[model samples]
Target chain A: MYEFDYRRPNTLDEALEALRTAPDGKLLAGGQTLLPTLKQRLANPSDLIDLAHIQDLKGISVEGDTLVIGAMTRHAEVATSPDVRARIPALAELAGDIGDRQVRNRGTIGGSIANNDPAADYPAACLGLNATITTDRREIGADDFFTDLFETALVEDEVVVAVRFPVPVRAAYMKFKNPASRYAIVGVFVAQNSDGVRVAVTGAGASGVFRVPEMEAALAADFATGAIEGIAVPQDDLNSDIHASAEYRAHLVGVMARRAVAACG
Target chain B: MTVTVSMTVNGEVVSGEVEPRTLLVQFLRDQLRLTGTHIGCDTSQCGACVVHVDGVSVKSCTMLAVQAENAAITTIEGLADGERLHPMQEAFRENHGLQCGYCTPGMVMSAIDLVRDRPDITEDEIRKGIDGNLCRCTGYHNIVKSIKAGAQAMKG
Candidate 1:
């Protein structure tokens, strides 16, 4: 690993200041991704702005119908938090199923969403449930927050503070994860609310996480596993690799959607 | 540039000057000479470097040494009390949980944390909870037995 300056700030203002002052700074949340990337020399930022010490950027709370989670909140906390489990059990279960226990102990939802990994689980939850991402500057809706593969609406020096997830009437996430890394090969999140039904698919899209209008519409009409039993997404845009074929992924999307719907009950 | 990072390791206040790129496993094995912590895989998938940071199991290889500053780290060396082995270690020994012993240290460390956090940890839970710690010796049956016994012992 290459040498770099490390900055640990105790306050949100200080962390933002550090990011602003550095020549090329990377915000360190759980360091589950950044540290490994740094070790491999994939990213060589001039400085690392450690967000672990920031006070306000940690915790989980329920405000009426929404669950507000701090950016620095670790995946382990989200998985085990009583408040989150009570409010959004499916979200908690998704958090619990992320890359093994050791990884979850250090990985954060904010970091996971901020990185916006195409295979990550949190993006599906955020998009499927229509969460609001609150950055240090402004609030960005879930639909607009994720722009592309490993990308977000966040600009340089813009730190994500918290994400607010509206509790759905009934929701669940099911993923066909890669056994080795536990990354989703084709994951589907089924969410139903008063607004309507939102079905999000991750680890399949060529660009990133996206909603399936057909599946959403079908599920909205019936809100059951049988409704989307025959759902078929385009195979041309899904991911195809040694582990799975694009056609297989499209098939799995339908299968996972059914499972997720069944799980919602 | 190197920085001084101080943390409580195995109940000892240890401080070391390391580069920002220094992983906690490297700091323990190379700098602190606590070689009980092993580095098995490069991609951080193998949990041979698993250790407790502030009472939670985490991959030491995936965390920078600077990040462990002011945190309490429990490595394989910290499990034993003087001459006696920790209950988890004893259970592993009694159950023949290791073959080559390469993954034992990390396996035991992870098991202790698993039982500590989840008291009623089932066999299925143990399989899932210790999913991070991979045993290349290919001895998972005894490892599961050891964890169940160790968890019960820890409760006693």
Candidate 2:
């Protein structure tokens, strides 16, 4: 790795100040993504502001109908938290299935959502469940959080503080994971809330994670696997790669959505 | 430039001044000479560099040594009680959990945390627990067996 200055700030204020002062500075949460990017020379930051020391960035809490998870909360914490599992079992299950134990243990929710990897699992949960992403600057809804491939609503120096997932009536996530990388080749998260039914697809979209309105409408009325039968997403909107074709991915969106609904049941 | 970091490693309080860019994995292996915590992939994909931070397993490869200041860490080297091997370690040996043994330490460390956190672990749970740790040799069959055996042994 290239040499760079490292600072471990105890408080978010100090960290934010350091980020403000430093040119091309990157915040280090779990380093599951950042470290790899650094090693591959994909990112060359002048300084690394380690956020692990900031106490406020960790922990999981349940407030009535919402599950408030700190930005820096490890995937393992979310996956295993009694409160999260009891309240949002699908969210917990989603956390548990992300990139194995080491990744879950080290990868933070903030890092995953921030990186916005097209194949990441959390974005689907965030979009499908209609979670609220709280940053130091302001709160962004899940619908607006994800913008495009490797893009998010967060601006530079705006740190994610927490993600508030409203307790859904029923929800589940299903993914066809790439065996080697464990990334989702095609994943779907089906959620039914008071607002209505929401279907989020990840690892299959060109614009990263996205929701399916047609599937949502079908499920909202019936909430059954057969509700979305023959509902094919457009191939142009889906992702194509060595693992799967765009058409295959489009087909998988329906199949995975069905599985997610069945699992939710 | 160096930063002073104070943290507990395997129940031992240790403090040192290290280069700002030094990784936590380097600190444990180079500074402390705890070689059991191997570095398989420089990237975070391989679980060979896993260790516990405040009782949670994290990829040391991704974290800087300075990030661990004042934190509690438990590496594979600290899992045993001097002469006696940790149950997970013993189970790996008995079940042939490893082939090259490069990923064994990390697998064992992750498994220990998994079993401790969920005592009622099932086969599927065990499979998902060590999903991060990759063993190209065993195809994860024997590794799963080792974790199950270790969980049973730790229960007693």
Candidate 3:
């Protein structure tokens, strides 16, 4: 790893100040992704603003009808939090299945969403549940927050503070995971709420996580696994790799969507 | 740039000056000379570098030394008491949970944390729980048995 200045700040304001001073600074949440990137020399930030000491960005709470999770809360914490499990069991299940035990112990939701890895699980949860992402500067809806592959609406130096998820009536996520890394080869999150049904697919999309409107409309009508039985996901935009071909991914998306809906019960 | 990192390792409070880029595993093996914690894969995929940071297992190779500041860390060297090995260690030894033993320290650490979190961890759960740790010898059958035995011994 290359040499860099490290600043462990105790407050959000102090972290923002440090980011402002160091033009090439990266915020270290749990050091799950950033540290690996640094180790591989994929990134060379001048300074690292460590946010682990910030007390404001760690907790799980319920306010009104929404479940609010502080960004810095680790995946392990989310997986085991009673509040999270009671409010949104699907979200808890998703958190419990990410990566592995040690990875979950150190990986944060903020880092996961901010990185926007196409194979990441949190993006599916965010989009499927219509979450609201609150950053230090402003609030961005889940639909608009994820802009592209490995991208988000967040600009430079903007720290994601929290994510607010509306508790769905019933929701579940299923994935055809790559056995080695446990990364989603093709994953789907299905949710039925007051508004309607939402079906989000991740790891398969060429751009990033996206909703299947047709499947959503069908499920909204019947709210059953059979609702999306014959609805074919277009293969044009799905990802293709050694793990799975684009056609296979498109096929698995339908299979996973049904599985998620079935698991919702 | 060099930074001063202070943390409690095993039960000892230790501090050292290291480069900002120094990994936690490097700090342990080089500076502290606690070489029991092996580095199987420099990448985070292999769990040979697993250790307890604030009582939770994490990959030390992926964490910077400075990030462990003031944190309580428990490595393989800290698991045994004087001459008596930890129950998990004893179980591994008795069950023949290893072949080459390259991944034993990390596997033992991960198993301890898993059993500590859930004393009633089943065989299926134990298999899934140790996903991060890889034994090249493919000796997981014995490893799982050791963890089950270890969990029972811990209750005693």
Candidate 4:
């Protein structure tokens, strides 16, 4: 790893100030991705502002019909929180199934959504459940949060504060995981909210997590495994990797979506 | 180039001075000489470097030593009471859960944590419990069995 200055700020204000003062400073939230990137020389930040000491960035609470999870809340916490499990069991199950115990324990939801890996599971949940990402600067809706692969609507120096997930009537997540990394090769999150039925697909997209409108429309009419029948997502915009081809991913998307719908039921 | 860090490691208070860029894994292994915590993968994929930070298991490889300042940590070395093996360790040994033993410490740490938090853990839950820790040798069958046995033992 390249040499860099490190600062552990106990308060979000101090952390934000450090980020504002230091050029090319990266905020270290759960470090599951950032540290590895730094070690591999993929990222070369001049300074690292560690967010672990910031108390405000951790915790989970229910606010009315929304589950408010702090940005720094670990996946393990979310996965095991009784409040989360009772209110949004799908979200809890999704968190529990993310990347194994270590990753769930170390990786934060904000970091996962901010990194916006196409194979990541959280983005699909965020998009499918119509969650709102509250950042240090502004709040971004799920539709506008993820910009592309490993990119988000967050500008430089903008830090994610918390994520607000509106409790859905019923929801479930299903994924075909890559054998090695355990990342989703193709994952689907199905949810029925006040807005209506939403179907989000991740890991299969070329860009990043996205909603499948056709599947959503079908499921909105009649949410069932059969509802997704004959609905084919275009393979042209899907991702193709050694684990799966674009067509295979498209097929997996439908299969996982149906399974998720069944699970939701 | 040096920073002062103070944290609770294995229920004991520890203080040290370290380089700004020193990883938490390095601190646990090199600085503190707590070598039971292994570093299998340079990336965060392998759970071989897992440890509890404030009762939550995290990948030590991804964190800077300075980041854990004033935090509470528990490693594989802290799992047992001196001479006795932790129930998870015993279960792993009995179930043939490990092959090369490289990932054993991490697997044990993660399993102990999983069992501690969820007493009613099932086979699928055990499989998902240590999903982050990779065992190229065991194919995870025995690992899952070990976790199940360990959970039962711990509960008893």
Candidate 5:
């Protein structure tokens, strides 16, 4: 790993100040992805502003019909939180199945969505449940948050404070995971609410997490597994790798969406 | 630049000056001479460096030594009580849960954390709980048995 200065700030203002002072600085959340990236020399930052010490950034609460999860709240906390389970059990299950137990203990919701890995699970939930990402500067809707693979709408100095997820009437996420990494080869999150039905696809998208309008329209009409069985995402826009072909991922999307719809029932 | 990091390890408060890039596993083995924590794969994929930080299991190799500042850590060395083996360790010995022994330390550490609160943990849960720790030897059959036995023994 490259040499760097480490600063643990007690408050958001101090962290922001540190980021400004160090020109090339990275905010260290759970460090699940950042630490590994550093070890491989993929990134070089002059300073690392650790966010673990900021007390206000760790919690889970429900406000109105939305669930507010603090940026630093770990995946394990989300998986086991009574509030999260009671309000959004599917979201809790998604959090529990990410990586593994140890990974869940350290990986946080803010970090997961901020990194926005194409194969990550949180983006699907964010998009499917209609989440609002509250940053140090402003609130960004989920549809506008994920821009590309490993990218987000966050500015250089901006910090993600919390994610506000509107509780859906019912939602379920199903993923065909890579055996080794446990990352989704093709994951689908299907949600039905009073607004309508939203079908979000992750891991298979070439751009990143995306919504399938055709599948959403089909599910909205019937709200059944068989209703969307024929609706398929095009292979041209899906990701293909050694683990699965674009055609296979396209096929899995239909399978997973159907399974997710069945799970929602 | 070097930073002074202090943390409670094995019930003893220890401090060391290390580079900001130094991993927690490196700090434990090189500076503190706690060699019991093995590094099977320097990458976080292998659970050979699993340790408890603030009563939760985490990959030590993925964490910076400085990140654990003022935290409570329990390594493989901290499990046994002076010549007497921990229940998990004893269960492993009884169940023949090891062959090459490279992955034993991590498996034991992860197993203890897995069964912390749950008394009647099922075999399927034990298999899933140790997903992070891989055992090339023993086929995980004995490891699963050992964790089940250990979970029962821990109830006492």
Candidate 6:
């Protein structure tokens, strides 16, 4: 952790101004990831723009059929919010299961999605539920928002305002967690929305979180765990480490997808 | 770059000058001389530095001192009366929840927050609640018992 300037902005406008002033500045959300990255000397930014003080960037509200969660809304709030539980229980359950109780108290969905960690749980929910990410300038669809591993479509100094999650008819996120770190070894999010059935897989893909059209198509025909029976994601491009093999990850993807679909019903 | 941060800790307003990279845990243990919070891992995986930031349990090591400016922080030292131990601490003593006690401060802090959030939580919920606080001594069985008893004591 090298010495650098820290700025606490009380408003989004002030935060944006701070970012504009410091080109190499990094936004501090819950600091669940960013601070640890600094402690390990993995990254060194010239300045840190802390968004913890912005009151406007925190809240949960329902707009029509969408659940608009402010970017800085803590995971604990989302997990316990009555609106979230009543509207989308699966999303709330996913929020509850992320990291741990202490982590949930501080970690935010916006920070989770913005970081775009390959093993993170929020990206699967965002992409699977087809949530819309709203920035200071414009709104970006989840499909377009996530670009690569630890990367997003956000431009320089772009500030995330909120994420609009369209209430799904039925959705569930299931993950095979790595015991030690609690990161998803292979996580699958299955959703039945007005548009169609959508399935997103995280942790296993080499290119990061991705959609499985084949599972989606199968689930669309029959909304049951049996619908995706015998379906398997290819193992070649998946991640393989000491925790799990690529082949095992591909297998767990199928297992988690089936479990998620079953959990929905 | 040095920065000045002031915050309410254990009901006392404390101010300190520290580097921008100074962690909340470092500020408490080094500057404020509150040594109850431990730092087991710098990677944020270990919850030995868990503390309440504005009434929420967070890993202090993962938060900057500057970030916690003007926030209300409650460390392990704030949990009890002058002489009497907090119910959670008493439960730990009665149940022998710790062996080496290296992770006790963080484990107790996390447990208190867990009970504060969900008072009627079950055994499975209690197990899941303290997942962030890892005890290397493998004394989780008694720790779980302690939390359940502590939650009951909190009610009484």
Model 3, span A154-197: residue lDDT tens: 99879999999999999999988999989999989999987998
Tens digits of per-residue lDDT for model 1, A125-218? 9999999999999999999999999999999989999999999999999999999999999899989976999999999988899999998888
lDDT by residue for model 4 (B1-23), tens: 88899999999999899988788
> Stretches of candidate 6 above 4 Å error?
B117-120
lDDT score, candidate 5, position A5: 95
Tens digits of per-residue lDDT, candidate 5, B1-156, equal 899999999999999999999999999999999988889975688798999999999999889999999999999999999999999999999999999999999899999999987879999999889999988989999999999999999999
Alpha-carbon runs more than 4 Å astray in model 3: none
- Identify the runs in model 2 with alpha carbons over 4 angstroms from their true place: B117-120
Model 6 achieves a DockQ score of 0.89
lDDT tens readout by residue for model 6, A1-265: 8777888888999999999999589998988888888888999898999888898889999999999999999999999999999999999999998888877888998899999999999999999999999999999999999999999999989989999999999999999999888899999999999999999999998878999999999999999998899998988889999999999999999999999999998
Off by over 4 Å in 4: B94-99, B117-120, B138-145
Clashing pairs in 6: none
What local distance difference test score does each model get?
0.92, 0.90, 0.93, 0.89, 0.94, 0.92
Query: Candidate 6, A146: how far from true, in Å?
Result: 0.9
lDDT of 6 at B152: 88
lDDT tens digits, residue span A160-254, model 5: 99999999999999999987789999999999976999999999999999999998998889999889878878899998889999999999999
What's model 2's overall lDDT? 0.90
Model 2, TM vs. native: 0.93
How many backbone collisions does model 4 have? 0
Best model number under DockQ: 1
Instruction: Give the per-residue lDDT of model 2 (tens digit) for A88-178.
Output: 9999999988887777767899989999999999999999989999998899999999999999999998999899999999999999999
Model 1 regions more than 4 Å off? B117-119
TM-score on alpha carbons, each prediction: 0.98, 0.93, 0.99, 0.93, 0.99, 0.98
Candidate 4 residue pairs in backbone clash:
none
Tens digits of per-residue lDDT, candidate 6, B17-67, equal 999999999999999999999999877877999999988889999888888
lDDT of 5 at A241: 86
Q: Which has the better DockQ: candidate 2, or candidate 5?
A: 5
